[model samples]
Target chain A: MTALTDDTLPVTSRGMRDEMIVFVVMALLLASVPFTGVYPFFVMQALCFALLACAFNLLIGYGGLLSFGHAMFLGTAGYCSAHALKVWALPPELGILVGIAAAFVLSIITGYISIRRQGIYFSMITLALSQLLYFIYLQAPFTHGEDGIQGIPQGRMFGVLDLTKPTVLYYVVLVGFLAGFLLIFRIINSPFGEVLKSIRENEQRAISLGYRTDQYKFLAFVLSGTLAGFAGSLKVFVAQNASLTDVHWSMSGEVVLMTLVGGLGTIFGPVVGAFVIIAMQQYLASFGQWVTVIQGSIFVICVLTFRRGVIGEIAHYFRRSL
Target chain B: MQALYAQLLVGLINGSFYALLSLGLAVIFGMLNIINFAHGALYMMGAFVAYFLLNLGGINYWWALLLAPIIVGIFGMILERTMLQWLTGLDHLYGLLLTFGIALIVQGVFQNYFGSSGLPYAIPDQLKGGMNLGFMFLPIYRGWVVVFSLVVCLATWFLIEKTRLGAYLRAATENPTLVRAFGINVPRMITLTYGLGVGLAALAGVLSAPINQVRPLMGADLIIVVFAVVVIGGMGSIMGSIITGFALGVIEGLTKYFYPEASNTVVFVLMVLVLLVKPTGLTGRAA
Candidate 1:
């Protein structure tokens, strides 16, 4: 006996047509952020995390794999891009691309080894692997141990664009966010993304359908890792620093909170979740350890009662994706 | 040779804690099928509880060894009944998330009250000195910890492997629904199993308090290492966890003597090797 699907909840779109319309509207809203007069730096930082969360959502929301070590990509790319800018004198765009490339390569190897197992085992592998990386970074000379790579020059966007100015940097981050968002949108709409969702919903059936599920998972992992890296690279510029904290397990936990708060398996959820969490942290910085406690409480409450996160609940209730 | 023997002693001490922690963890996992992320937090709490008893009520370390574990066990059982019990029928990952939240909350609360700086818990007067072996002078407290934890680990292994209650626990593990149909209060057993498992951690905490400074993060890092130890040992059996814990700890300790730089990573490196050889872990059944 099939129980009632939670799909009839409000904000849930009945079909793909409405999804496209809402997607356009959301993009337009983001496009208009320049006129809002809020601090460009904060928005830039949020967008970076949002993009990283969206990329993370691609795997968990669509592929049903919860990676606990995703911050590896974020931190790796941030460190890589920062190093490139500082040591190689590469401009922002090229440096960020290089960072993404490095993460993409690392994800391929990590994804390959990790995909050999599933579920809890998969999570453990990633966590342990990243922890291993964390130690390596802590010791590696370029990282400067605990102090991290700091005060890297905010190189100009190309030769003509001035990144030192806050407004210009804001647009750079905004564009990066939009590009990453659209890329996620494109992938989800594409055939590859559909197969991924099908696999997530029922892996056995997908395998029976002759789809190379492992390859798809590997590709998805790389894509997710690459985008996460790009976001991290962008964040280095926004925050003007890269540190061990970015790659720590806690950072990975924060991303999970973001994706969950926004809405897993829903577009636009990560953005909403990122802003809410980031704003919460910004205000609650003085509380120190309480932030962790509150975040944990939210995790428990959401998993137990909410089940559906903010955007997920809203989408489920209204019968449309916002 | 002398340095190697001393490093081995250090490794064994580390291993004793690992063995005890992993043994408890394996027991809980065997019954609950939920990885208790709060395990480290409970271990920390066990020590803190003892510390509190000593500082606040003037209860000494000896009394703490007796009382702290029971208190932690009862607390753990309550958690199992209240929160963890609900998540049972769902995905194993959900249980992990719930417990992780619990771990965060417990650690956060303790950190709030005590801050990050660790408090020292002194060794009892009974276990104050060291034995000067021909090769190595072993601290009495360290030797006591290794032997005491070994006794605890072996006793637990015997309970599960030889006794009747453990039989019920194991039978429930194989098929809880069937065990429940047989009129066994499987739910209560599961809850108690978690408590017992956590009690084991608390005992380790009490044992370890004197050796390692009691801190909010004491068990955080240690748990991760224990996880690697568990993976390496393969949680297929309680004996497996114990053997792997001690063996790996000694290996790590020896690594510290021979090639100190690789000491931090020797365990992880071994884990990678184990995965390559048998992805299920050295003693773990293939999932």
Candidate 2:
């Protein structure tokens, strides 16, 4: 699962230009969403998930660490951000920071324990740890148990940009998603990203080259988790609630599906995948549980036939790393 | 004292399920190199199969016990033959993803029909009463579940550790090419091994139905806990999973008595502690 062909493609200057072009095109398309009047709420929710999937892609797609419990970060961040905004009366910016900081600490602690192992064990360990948190949040008073921290206040950012306004919130979420996407994009192309990819491809070889592979993997895990937390914080503003649904293992699976559907290693794939899945859910909302069945079928199909994903296939056909 | 004994019994019963499920996981992992994420869903399917048999077919508990595993085992073999077989030689993660998809589909379809509620499965006539021991009153069906699960687990162990076929299975696990060179059909063995593991899970589901009630998502959360047990026990040996599963269940039961709040989290806590102390697990060799 970690060994996708796109990760191995040589990063020439032309490939970099192609990715930049796709990123700009994607940004413009998202920025013009409000004007197109295609339901700002749906796009905002999808943007949040797109960021989450991108954060997830940073780990599994590049770092070769598949943390099955990525939802823990998202849940923790949302809960914290919700509590901060609602209970503490913190501004939107501070609430988001609180969420990010909590996720940062959580990822560090979890990464320390989980990164000790690699491959499947890493996935299981992270999963177990996340379940541990899920139970904690279930019992914790701040989360209000099953009711969750609902009706969170979407306070103005710096007392200027009002988050309660839908259009303003959408742009804020869009900008947050873009910043996170670019950060991940930059990280993947950096020298450190190269080392992380090497560790993914062959950890022993990377270690032989004096890379201190564990630290590199640990850093990648932390970054991916924190960014996932950022997405969660952004999500609380959009959803106006923090609930168990975000933290559930099923949500983790959904992020994985999105990445797989969009193409794991492709820069633009998660963005497209996020839209595709969230749109599927929005359109198929009446089908209820069948959505899960459909998503599962997608997972099976992706693994069996569409392993390269939509973006992956397109990039492969064009011989470009979009 | 009575309450403690009761919780201990409850823990023992849970330990039985955990041991059965994790033991099957270890066996399948050894053969297939895939961590059978669908094991939980298959276990749930077993309970549902028993429900369907009793409610629809009017089959008795005893027959359901005999048939649920076989039926679910065949379903598992088909799954292995049709879907899981293609995952050979890919990254282990792909197998996990594929099986996870299977689980979601199975559980989702069941939930669609069952509505996420628990459906009752009555204890069989012979095991409807309770016996008062010196320490505690033991429900006969609960006792049956524990004892029967122990017997099944042990029989599985004996079959795998002591028999000729077991040697071939173990040898194939070590090197499928060499085992195939010795005239054993390796792929067939892989399918049968999957069936056996899945059958064990289904059997656990059957045992759990009367006590826990049949539910669509029954195995969903339980699988996560079993994964913790697997990590703590290290999935290295058969006995390791059994002992760890039971021990953790007992510990969880004790926690429910002493600190009810911690009962849900104790296994995961122990997994972390184990990883910190011995990353390879108690009886596991290095991964």
Candidate 3:
């Protein structure tokens, strides 16, 4: 049972030091990728999903709440930001803020409803709520039905940095990703994070210890949702559209696959997982439906055999958390 | 009035599916403690199996109805033996993740071969067309679907609640170790329970093929709604699941008549309301 509860796995100072070193090296490498021949847009897209996966990890990994419908946050933020940029003509930063705000409020309502149930029912509730939103977006006039909010302006940031430049957009996305990553890292190290882990390990014990476990779980849910929205808002500028695909259940599944393959509870696992999966999709684009088949195979393999994931496995081998 | 009656009929038909699928989920959850995320994929496979039997093997609907479930159930049993067996004694969430993976694989393979356009399954000659009623034209096939599904649901409820085998199953669910100590092969029973649950999903797929085209992704979305149904019904009481399934369907139908925009969302809204009122679900035992 403890083995299954990966979220509550103890964190060590040595593991934190190693994780920081890996983060710095990875950041420097990502920053220099533009200088190389690798496509910056692809990396930007992957960064967005990486951040999304990380936010998802914050809940499932640290909070032990597997939300099956995370795409609602991403999609909500994307739509809000896209609408702000396209309809209200707001600047990019403000648009992103609007998106985050929307996601924050949505999460509050959804978290209130969802936290009432535990385990599988919690997952189902999140999924149902997201599906309900999906239908609304599908029919709502503001979303333009199937066409979505397309050709959204990348718009200058703070009326200074011209985001139309590929490198500029890439760096903006990277900054957003890094900020989100550090926030999650900080959150998990805080006393609040400890309370969350306690609840995850045993809610009954936590409640007995006089901890308001539901409040902690709800806050974690909101934080995860807000961060996921931030990632989604960043993505709209890169993808230049907010569409149905973002809100689809498959998108939710894709994020889960990303988190699972990277290692559910590890800090760096989701980033690696996101990169691996996004890269696979990029290279396998020509393979058509085989991409799904391959992704599915990876899922089956990971669940059955490689539950620790790539970074998690490496971390285990090194006897340190990644 | 005619439109209302027609919508109600549609609701009843959809309710039958809700009842059938959710009932399968409850049974599987009761025994295996796995959510069976692949249940939808299994349902899709059931439809596809029927499709293949008709097109490739020249089998009739009646034969496909009986055979598809058995074949798919056997396939499910094999899956239980091979993969799902390993997941026992772990957190129930692992079972969910594993099954979700299996679902993606199953749906993806079908999509690769069948495409998403959907293949038509002809209604058997004996069940084709409709009967004219006073207010609205009642499709005989639709009526047959409701009635037949009701029978299946009741029969399943009876088997689980009233039979000797069912007592063993309930006993195992309460205490597998104790049941094993009593000389029953609990592992094999678990596999058979999974098979029976999968078979029920297949049965629903076979029934739905003629009404809804046999498509690869058909069950993909439908399964989510069934999950909501399970949440509302509280996966604890078998009869509660059936009654709630049908009630929600009719409510959805009435919503379609009153506010079409809300028809798809009404069930989920109801689920939220139910969760707020009774977090363990209508009849579910406390976790």
Candidate 4:
């Protein structure tokens, strides 16, 4: 999860301008994609994972925290939102909110305990907590054990826009992804984000500089978890089910893979990585177990050879943060 | 009371696997500074190797137990030479990611060939009976597993805590450069340590083959619990890992008897409690 060497470089106004231009262009391109005859559901699914990866990137890239159990947030949010829509019959927006709220609460609890330890221990703590939750969900009556919460209605957005239409759902997902992306962007540029970066670079130095580094890390973790939950909730609308796969550790690993492949620290890396991975999975679905093998090889390749990732490598070549 | 005894036996069996796996993790972490995420995959590989030996080569359980570990340990050594060696001096997280990838590859390959349905490994002829102590009947294999693993754990502890080779290992862990200056091949030691650790995981797999059906994903879920165990024990002390492993197993077994629904989650809940009370873990050095 190494950032590009250029990540340490000071951000200039010109660099910010260039980044803004790229972000807008990318957003516009994605917005125009529905007209291009590509499968809207596929893009929507990719967008959800992209948002999840971006949320994950906020912690590992900027805050130097590697959370191995991020699937818990996604799974928790998906299950909550699905339950809200199906059982409570809440509107789509409120259902999403319920999901995000569950993630928020979970993040606070997990983040509080996890921040006590650093490095590998933190990852293990998150993983174990998620696994604990996984077992709980596996037996919980609400989750239906092996069956999961299924056939969730894509309820109206704000009681107006019909989500049953593929195009409308796609646009809604896109908007959610963009808003989440912009929020992460703003957070990284904020003073709080700077403190997180400092802690990441050197925690002892940040502590000596009078920053309660743990608080910064904890806050970043919570934000990441919340956004990931938002993505998970969005995904439930498109996928129409909340299953055990969302909470599985492999799902967490997939998000990490996305972040790593796209560029751990780069702003746009995870989106690209998410699309790349999701598309690979989509097309290679018939390959069965080879997909896992391929994903594993990519992980080995990314770590051993190209630690900078796709966008990180590009940013390094251009000498600018992406 | 009989039910309690049965549950305790189950817990002891599970604890044997935890202790064996966590002990390997501690040994690897001590020398390599890597958590050895592939340890589980290697454990699964150990079981598969035993399966292959018996099915393909007409080998017996006893011989497979001895051979599988050696074979898997050699494979681990090769992995160290090829992939893991390059990751030295990098962040410990990289090692984790790399090993995670390796695990996926190993598990995926096994799944492709074997399918998810588990293959059976029969109990050896010598271990095919039970002893009845009036309260409950104890499967001899289960009892042997607990006793044998404890002996293995203690032997490993003694080797690391008392042997001169262990002294070199501890010295390397502290200051690799200083030890290198003193003419010890620390790199070779690191590689061998990884092999030894992988071998221990394999040994656990071989032991577990008859009880737990040999499946591709066998080690996948089991490793997570072992990670929880490692966290509670704090990867600092060998004895701490062993004691914690056995103790947590019994606790989980008791939980199974009283509250069967929570059997899967008891270890993790215990980890949370341990973390809340002792952030550095029970015996871990302050990081």
TM-score of each: 0.96, 0.98, 0.98, 0.98
Taking every candidate in turn, the Cα RMSD to the unseen true structure, in Å, is 2.3, 1.4, 1.3, 1.5
Provide all candidates' interface root-mean-square deviations: 3.5, 1.8, 1.3, 2.4
Better of 1 and 4 by lDDT: 4
Model 4 TM-score on chain A: 0.97
The sequence of per-residue lDDT tens digits that candidate 3 reaches over residues B208-285 is 999999998999999999999999888888899899889988999999999998998999999989888888888788
Pairs that collide, model 4? none
Q: What is each candidate's fraction of native interface contacts (fnat)?
A: 0.44, 0.76, 0.65, 0.69
Q: For candidate 4, write residues A57-110 as lDDT tens digits.
A: 999989988999999999999999999999999999999999999999999999
For candidate 4, give the lDDT of residue B266.
96
Candidate 1 lDDT over residue span B1-287, tens digit each: 87888889889989998998888888888888787778999999999999999889999998999899999999999999888888766656666777878888999999999998889999999999888888788889988888988988999999998999989988998999999999999988988899899999999898888878888988887877787787777777889899999999899999999999888878877877777778788777877
Indicate the worst ten consecutive residues by lDDT in candidate 3 chain A: A6-15
Per-chain TM-score (chain B), model 4: 0.99
After superposition, the stretches of candidate 3 with alpha carbons farther than 4 Å from their true spots are A1-3, A6-15
Q: lDDT tens string, model 3, A1-322?
A: 4535563233443446787899999999999998998989899999999999999999998888999999999999999999999999999999999999999999999999999998888998999999999999999999998999999999899999899999999899999999999999999989999898788778889999999888999999999999999999999999999999999998999999999999988899999999999999999999888888888889889888888888778877777878
Model 1: which docking level applies?
acceptable
Using lDDT as the measure, name the better of candidate 1 and candidate 2: 2
Error of 1 at B163 (Å): 1.2
What is the RMSD of candidate 4?
1.5
Per-model CA lDDT versus the true structure: 0.85, 0.92, 0.92, 0.93
- Candidate 2: the clashing residue pairs are none
**In model 4, which regions exceed 4 Å deviation?**
A1-14
